[model samples]
Target: MTLIEEVKAIMQRSASDEYLNVMVPLLEDYVKAECNNTFRKNGKTVYPGGVKIFIAKACEHNLTVSGVSSKRLGTVSYSYDLDFPDSLRRLLNPYRRVRFHAF
Candidate 1:
């Protein structure tokens, strides 16, 4: 299986919302690394390695596997919506404030 597939499999097996919470950062890091490699080779300003696509796919899979709706909170924000399971809601609070600005 490919690395992405492996990551998907690992995500599929996790139960705790905390685990999903932790996985997001790791997946983002993976995507960023791939994007950087592509940018380095192609000299492109945009991420040409489909990092966003991968992130979306991984997030979708995570939601489906966990039975939650992972909605985009903003351009660079995401959160588990109201449809998430109660167990998860208690563990994953999406209402926490976060700050980000685009220059």
Candidate 2:
């Protein structure tokens, strides 16, 4: 399945197509930035399986906490710092590129 279709399935029809079209690519770009753009090399691009899932999950998280820095639900409260999530960062560790400089 395509990325949008896969993400839509996981979201369970929560987001609109227009929103997904905009957010999915933005999130994918975020992932590529976090991983140092290794997915693109020498005019060829590739994405590992996990990357796709990560993008979908990130989209969900963004939709869940689109606005407001903090929210309260009954006795429960949540805060959004808007930083890249640590959990998502873990997923990208395997793909992160490291460069070494010559001495």
Candidate 3:
């Protein structure tokens, strides 16, 4: 399965709010550190782009429809926005690119 799929599986398997609360930050940190390492090695940033796509996909996969539209759960929203890139603002339009938000 893809990384996005793996993350979704992890979320689905979480037992409680505490599990989600704990895992999300570790996931964000892993993604950010991975992105930084990739940027350093390749001289360009691609991991964050991958992370953005993963988050968007994850939201779509897991979000619930409250009424006419869908809204992500708090954990999903938090993970989606964590450490998003700002430089590729033009390429990734429409979606809000969050830099980082620590809880």
Candidate 4:
């Protein structure tokens, strides 16, 4: 599939070229980084599911729609988090791209 087709299918619509330009490279780099080596076979993906993996990951990273915030109580006890969801990890797990950490 072509870039436009992939973007539309993944993003659920046709995003701007500028938006795609940014995310496509980011997606490529992210997969390569996760592979910890190469993510290619004969100038293409080594894995058949590679494109879906990239799409899922890039979509996860692109969840930029802001949530509503309130300071109604007149206190300063506000918090924000941007942790990745478990579903996303599950989606990438089959590709062995799920990051693990020691803490």
Candidate 5:
């Protein structure tokens, strides 16, 4: 199966086609930036290794897109669900260019 198809599957019908397109790219771009575009190493791309991370981030991105689907958060606002899942946070935090600093 294609990479995008994999991402779409992990999304589990939460995101629409258009939103999925947007989010999947964000995951890719974020990875590229974090890895200094070196997703390829030893003649291989990390894309395979990072599939789960990509899907998690894409679902997180869908939350940001206001595409809450059948998640069943609540009425009027799903402000609570706006927080991205901790798994995505754990995956992306290390890859982030800027590290958090505690005061």
Candidate 6:
């Protein structure tokens, strides 16, 4: 299945096609950025299998947490993470690239 289809399946029927159309590519880019693009072998770029699933999950996460940052009901409070989730970070760690800069 395509990435968007996977995302739609993950979401169990999303209400907005336009939102999916726009955000799926953006989330894919985010996943690529987190992985530092892709691994190049013999001048050919190769992507791992996990990336597509990661993008789909990330899209679901983004949809779930969009707009609201924090909330309070009485003394209890909740905070929504606006950044890339740590759980997702852990999943992508194997593909992550660390860059060394010379200053």
Best prediction by lDDT: 2
- Model 1, residue pairs in steric clash: none
State every prediction's TM-score relative to the real structure.
0.28, 0.71, 0.27, 0.57, 0.50, 0.64
Candidate 5 structure quality by residue, lDDT tens digits, 69-94 = 44444555433445555665566544
Model 4 regions more than 4 Å off = 50-57, 60-83, 97-103
The local distance difference test score of model 5 is 0.59
Question: Which tens-of-lDDT digit does each residue in 1-103 have in candidate 6?
Answer: 6656666776644637788889877876776777775567889755565666566666667767453678899998878767766776677777888877999
* Model 3 lowest lDDT segment of ten: 59-68
Quick one: how many clashes does candidate 1 have? 0
Tens-digit lDDT track of model 4 for 1-103: 7654565566654566777767676666665666554556789754445456556455545654332233345765544344445656455555554567999
Better of 1 and 6 by lDDT: 6
Better of 2 and 3 by lDDT: 2
Pairs that collide, model 5: none
Q: RMSD of candidate 3 to the true fold?
A: 14.4
Q: Which residue pairs show backbone clashes in model 4?
A: none
* Root-mean-square deviation (CA) per prediction: 13.7, 4.3, 14.4, 5.4, 6.3, 4.3
* Candidate 1 off by > 4 Å: 1-25, 32-45, 66-103
C-alpha positional error of residue 95 in candidate 1 after TM-score superposition, expressed in Å: 35
- Please report, in order, the local distance difference test score of every candidate based on alpha carbons: 0.45, 0.77, 0.43, 0.57, 0.59, 0.69
Query: Against the true structure, whose TM-score is highest?
Result: 2
Better of 2 and 6 by lDDT: 2
By TM-score, is 1 or 6 better?
6
User: How many clashes in each structure?
Assistant: 0, 0, 0, 0, 0, 0
- Model 1 TM-score (2 dp): 0.28
Runs off by more than 4 Å, candidate 6:
10-15, 39-47, 65-69, 72-80
| lDDT over C-alpha atoms for residue 38 of model 5 | 46
